[model samples]
Target chain A: MPNTFAVPDYFVSPTLLTRARTIAQEHASLAKRLATDYDVSAARRLGELQSTSTAVREYDEAHSALEELQSLLTSTDQELRELAEEDIQPTRDRIEQASAALKSSLVPVHPFAHLPCLVEIRPGAGGDEAAIFAGDLVRMYKGYCARVGLRSTQLKYDTADEPTHVQEAVLEVDSPGSYGMLRCEAGVHRVQRVPATESKGRTHTSAASVLVLPSIPTEGGGDMGEASFDDPKSDYYVDPKEVKLEVMRAGGAGGQHVNKTESAVRLTHLPTNIVVAMQDSRSQLANREKAWQLLRSRIAQLRREEREEEIAKLRRGAGAGKVGRENKVRTYNWGQQRVSDHRSGLDVRNLDNVMEGGEALERIMQSVRTWMAEQEVLSLVAEEENSQAQKK
Target chain B: MPRLAPSLLRQARAIDVLLPPLLPACRDLRSAENELRWLKDHAIKTGRQCGLAHSDASLKRLVARRARGEPIQYILGTEYFGDLELKCQPGVLIPRQETAASVTHLAQQLSKKRKGRPSDLHILDLCSGSGCIPLLFHHEFYAQPGNEHCKLHMVGADISVQALELARRNQKSQIAAQSKRVTAQTTSLAAMRFLHADVLLSEAANAIHAPIGVVEALQQLTNTRPTPAYEVLISNPPYISSQAFRTTTARSVRNFEPKLALVPDNPSSAPSALDGDVFYPRLLALADQLRTEIILFEVADIDQAQRVATLLARQSTWRTVEIWRDEPGATSDEADHVLLDGGESVPVRGAGNGRSVFAYRGAAAAWLQ
Candidate 1:
């Protein structure tokens, strides 16, 4: 039987109700604009304009604005949903008395918010047994992905020899709630078990580390525009002496043409000693443009790194050194069949069920959210104390 | 002015006459001439001067072997890299030109970095194969001033015993040829040891056959040194992707090398069971633990290089990853900005050639941070 759960009455606090009304009105306005203003005829004309020189800029600007508006609507909807949940949680006991719901639906917010997490799990010092445990940890993740209905994509993977053991594997899990849920899964995971390959069933210790990154929206993705590059209004010329351009015939996997022509252009920035080559393009101009694109991205990446460093420095001053430090996070001991998240201080004994994912993940996710809420409260209290001290 | 000696001209003529039959199919006149000159010089130095006709026959056989897809070095039984004559064996991956470039880079860096001109530097070469890397380093470092006091305590590790034996032979021949050079050293024996070890093995016992003391010494040198045990960590491990193994033409695959070295053994293993790129991660982990100051890893192409850069960027420890090309005169920070998929120009750094990842640990972090 599917258990039914109701949203509690206290969840509908006055502040939350006002916020929800404002969000609904904004969403309605966006819906109206999307329907009436964004007509099929205009879209077709816009597509045509996109291909033409005269109207292309206008078309692009319009498209960007539309995208921004749509994102705004989506964000507003998300915020309203979170507010609803906050209001509902206060009346949790009343909701439980109301109905038994099999599928518990809380607003599924993207879990990796606010905190950048580091996951580290390595095969412990125990030889093949350690390696084997590393392999199991990787599988446990895959199983966890399935349970959470998350998709696991290989960011990188390294395979061992015959009698297969995973030397190392890094996987990126895509889910709304992954970063928050997997944050609990960082640090040294120790495994104690008899190797399947061993004749004498002797227990050995192994370890693996997992790092979770809350996939931040890129610079221009949302309201986080601080890191986005402001395009220089004026054209800047690279000193002729500073730039070295070499034309070469591109090689590898590409066809005979790859070896035939000097289509590939290698640009060397002498000042920075950075070299970018683009041979994938058919023409030299295209290749140069491609190379420039790569260069810009790198510069942008550097800027992003600088911003992160500054924020980290500030955080250190604020006495939250342990929050973002890439040291210890979590541990999984296969011998004990236990997984522990050091940050939240939560331990789950059912390794198999957790690895398999789903309901097991829900419990872990709840624990993480509670931890996050407590941290927020602590931060608020600290701020209040600082203000009070200033007045005194 | 020194004129061309008649005897030298005569030998050159003899080598020239023998070269045609040796390289009948080869069209590059310059390459053929270079080969002949090299071989003739070797023959004359060894005092095993051959008649013009006999030299022709030998050259022809060597050329024929090359034409039949055998590496020229393997056919000749030797190849000179740096100052060492390394043995080239069948089934072993030949030392590549890019590898030579990286070795030279490391040697130059090490010479500049090390203090007091120490008589010997402890160096470990994993996946040593024919021990070309250690041999080159030994030859170069020994030739430097104050290096006479410098003993090169070198260890070459490889899982293949056959390869290890071949490497040992190569080292022996090199040491014998340079015995006079070796005698200039004042320190204890310039120890050169080979241990059969699989880097992939989590346990040392699964791989190494050395005595406990030796093992402990090596481990200590690797871990506890005020400076890293090895001034430089260099490896050209099997980096061929599984996709390449599966999809490469038969001419390149079946005709050239062993599948064991090229592809991961079990293709059908679960995603969790297999690491797609095995050597790179292991090297990274080793670097992390051993804290080796410098690492030079050979990769296939730009895509792999980019993947490595991304992998390194994700790590807290690794920083300042710059790719190098096979070509000379390549700079590390040569930025050529081009637009990306979103039409944004990104700065390109390093040798924009066949992909090679050259990164330093603390330096890059310090620079960027």
Candidate 2:
């Protein structure tokens, strides 16, 4: 069979190899330090570098094997030359696999990659039809999580008057590292189908936006040092002063005089004007805690995106333009029964399988993840080229 | 109360037949919906556990009980105080968010002062309703990594036997919930005790059988502290005056919560102060007797907080005194100060109505500052 997994005619870039070597060296020193005296940040960094160091080792071994095989190709014996030639192709293929792994491992790991995520789905366009599609997407995600054996909870599901219509829904994928696996599903998703609300039998275009955020634990999980709110340098660290907390309590005496059960809590990050309101839990304390968590996740995501935008501007790949939240990442065409990922350019004919979050959905997500890693490598190459040009 | 709109009631009824019954107490559609959801969840869980009749029937009954102005905490039998969920009964006052906020703020300050150094700490809560204050304090303080090493002794005293019983039940449930997170070796539940005592009556005024004073009762209950000098004294005592209870208290509170927890008995007997203000003098005297370093007393509003602060100032015992608003940590633009009858004034921290009077003396002066 043809090796479809192989990147066609791929070669390892010198800049990427140099980056990988430095990472391997850092990993070695971190491992030594970790053995003698343990530190949380040091351990976490070491974990991130594990894959990069492995890939570097594999690449080095494959390159040496290929060179050894090439040297034997020059043997005076005809039998030896033929054997060396036959083995060279396989060794070269091994080298190509290592190169691809090395390239992907160099892409910076997302800071929130280890955390469980909150997937928020909101209708973007096409009014009522968009709302219906948003509902479908919510179910699709829930189905995906169930199929994958990931624990999921619907944090907030606001439904409209019509059946199968949703205003907004937030699904908390409660499995750790789900953020890393599901983050590529973010951005606008466009859908084309004949809506139930439609009078005419014509296909119409609608869109819904998906936002995935890290669900940071509230207390005692302080081991997530950088993600914990106590650290001022952490993106999750929100100044208590900047937040405005509103409780829906009766105006009269609050303590013993009132027995009101209104437990809704709203927190607004005043600087960014990001508001998170939670009334899902009957306990006021629980609602307040959930609100604070949602607020922190959103603020952290915003801050990280802002930093990414600055880096992307510097990297500036011409063909690799940034596909942000506004850009359509995937399309679901009901008429053609096709689900297409815009970035990966992968299309699946089984619409039912995609909507059911079956193998087709997994295939699309895997393609997008690969496409994202390639984009990261392209940006790294672009950065190297920019710096070299400046040196000239 | 004004009548709920027909349209709103219909809307609630449309949501769930049980939801409309909650609208009168909840006063709005959103809260009614929330209460109904919680009630339904409570019904199913408890019914299934106890093997009771249908949860749907129980849900209808719970909705009816809520409509008649019963506190949801009492109906559900649990209320969240800080991170600890305390069991609630009708007689014991439900733990308030304001009280939790003050307790949390104090715990944060205490932990910050400890700075990983372990030391013996004792807390006394007067008129402890569901034992919420001390249990919450223990939860917050021991949440820090090094605090489990520190010897924590807590005493919660209430006049009513029912309150004390609920307090002990709350402690058991808290320990059960806490044991899942922490190892048994470091559990401070042993050091915590609940006693039945009336703060208003002096030891001389009461019979030998009935414990009247906090310090005397605590010494009788525990062997570790024969004469305990607590580090902190906290209380959310019955502070609402008889007139306020009649004029200002909510219908749910007036109709359902224990009257012993809401209004102090016999205002005419306490000649010097308002009926609600009667508890402060007794608590202050107890604080002095116990040699309590820090005291936090919950009040009705700014006026009451000022009155309590003035009472504390008259003794010149505390090094520093501050009144904290509903949210003690929140920043505000307005100048926060409560003007006393004297030319001097005390600083008020945070925003909203002044909810607590916080004072620290001796070693605690340095900790709070």
Candidate number achieving the greatest lDDT relative to the actual structure: 2
- Cα deviation at A389, candidate 1, in Å, is 99
Where is the poorest 10-residue window by lDDT in model 2 chain B? B178-187
Q: Residue B66 error for model 1, in Å?
A: 2.7
Q: What local lDDT does model 1 show for residue B336? A: 41
Clashing pairs in 2: none
> Fraction of native contacts in model 1?
0.00
Q: In lDDT terms, how accurate is model 2?
A: 0.83
What candidate 1 gets wrong by more than 4 Å, as runs, is A1-392, B1-60, B113-121, B142-152, B179-189, B204-231, B245-254, B257-276, B327-355, B362-369
